[model samples]
Target chain A: QKEVEQDPGPLSVPEGAIVSLNCTYSNSAFQYFMWYRQYSRKGPELLMYTYSSGNKEDGRFTAQVDKSSKYISLFIRDSQPSDSATYLCAMKFNYGQNFVFGPGTRLSVLP
Target chain B: DAGVTQSPTHLIKTRGQQVTLRCSPKSGHDTVSWYQQALGQGPQFIFQYYEEEERQRGNFPDRFSGHQFPNYSSELNVNALLLGDSALYLCASSEYGIHTDTQYFGPGTRLTVL
Candidate 1:
């Protein structure tokens, strides 16, 4: 199985809609789960990170990690065109330096 | 506070050539990690450096190497590059010894290998 898996979505959503992005991993040992957003011609910007299970919310973004299911999610509320970009899920083992990234999901938010 | 910065925003090279990309990490951060992102793909881990030493590396070949300086800056060197090396090379910075320190990324250098 792939270490990390995400739907390479070209998901389209209208303005003010709720957008949900998710990823699953085969490795149960991953402790740090991160969500990154990348615009065209730009490097990834870290959106949110979760240490273990449960949910974390910041502004319009909310991240959830369920270690038991090896699943993680990012929810964007009231999405705007600016929120359109490639969303990537990355995770790493405890005390490990490298991150294993899943194939990003491309999102397009329409005005 | 300045964020992580990388130089030569774009580069072009041919097969079998060598390229060196530089990075200045975010201030107060001592660890630097490199990643390669091809078109339509997520960034792939290249390696990490701390204390001017290589701490961890990914599955890339030996032709891909890196060096860290005392000032917490770094360089990624690709020897005998292949067409597949065409991608955006990113440098990320984080503090050492912090289990949960977030990595701040630079804008990245785009390399096109023909």
Candidate 2:
């Protein structure tokens, strides 16, 4: 099984709606969880970052991690057309080390 | 400040041909990491360079090699490339010794092996 698993979602939602993107990992050693946003033909941008199991809020994006379940999630509130992109979850055991990335979920917030 | 910069934004090569991609890390950053992203997939870590040496490597084959110059710039060279070698190559930079350092990525070089 892949170290990280995420649904390849082409999930479509209306503007102003709440969207939840999630990922699960098989490696319990992963301690740092991160969410990245990538637009078409662009590099991935860091959206949210969390260490261990906890919740972190930044602007309209909230990242939640449950170490016990080896799950992580990114919640986008008041989604906008600009939010349409691929959401990727990544995790690492040590700083500046190799990070495992999920397949990513494609999201489109339609107007 | 300029983020990580990759050269040859796009490239096309034939099977069995070799390819070299270049990257200059962000200002004040001393570490560089390379990743390969296939179509519709997340970037896969290839290797990382710090202090002019490879500190970590992923599951890639020996055909994939890299070099880090004294200036902290890096190069990823693939020999005997196959069709599967075609992918978007990304370069990320971060400051060594910074515990919470997040990697800043470049626009990436798109490689197409024919």
lDDT tens per residue, model 2, A1-111 = 998999998999999999999999998999989899999888898898788899999999999999999999999999999999999999999787777899999999999
Please provide, for model 1 over A8-98, each residue's C-alpha lDDT reduced to its tens digit, 9 standing for 90 to 100: 9899999999999999999898999999999998988999989999999999999999999999999999999999999999998865468
TM-score of chain A of 2: 0.98
- Per-residue C-alpha lDDT of model 2 across residues B1-114, encoded as one tens digit per residue: 888899999999999999999999999999999999999999999999999999999999999999999999999999999999989999999898677877888989999999
lDDT of each: 0.94, 0.94
| Candidate 1's TM-score | 0.98
DockQ of predictions, in order shown: 0.73, 0.78
Candidate 2's iRMSD: 1.0
Tens digit of per-residue lDDT, candidate 1, span B1-114: 999999999999999999999999999999999999999988899999999999999989999999998898999999999999999999999988787787888999999999
Which residue pairs does candidate 2 place in steric collision?
A: none
Model 2 interface CAPRI class? medium
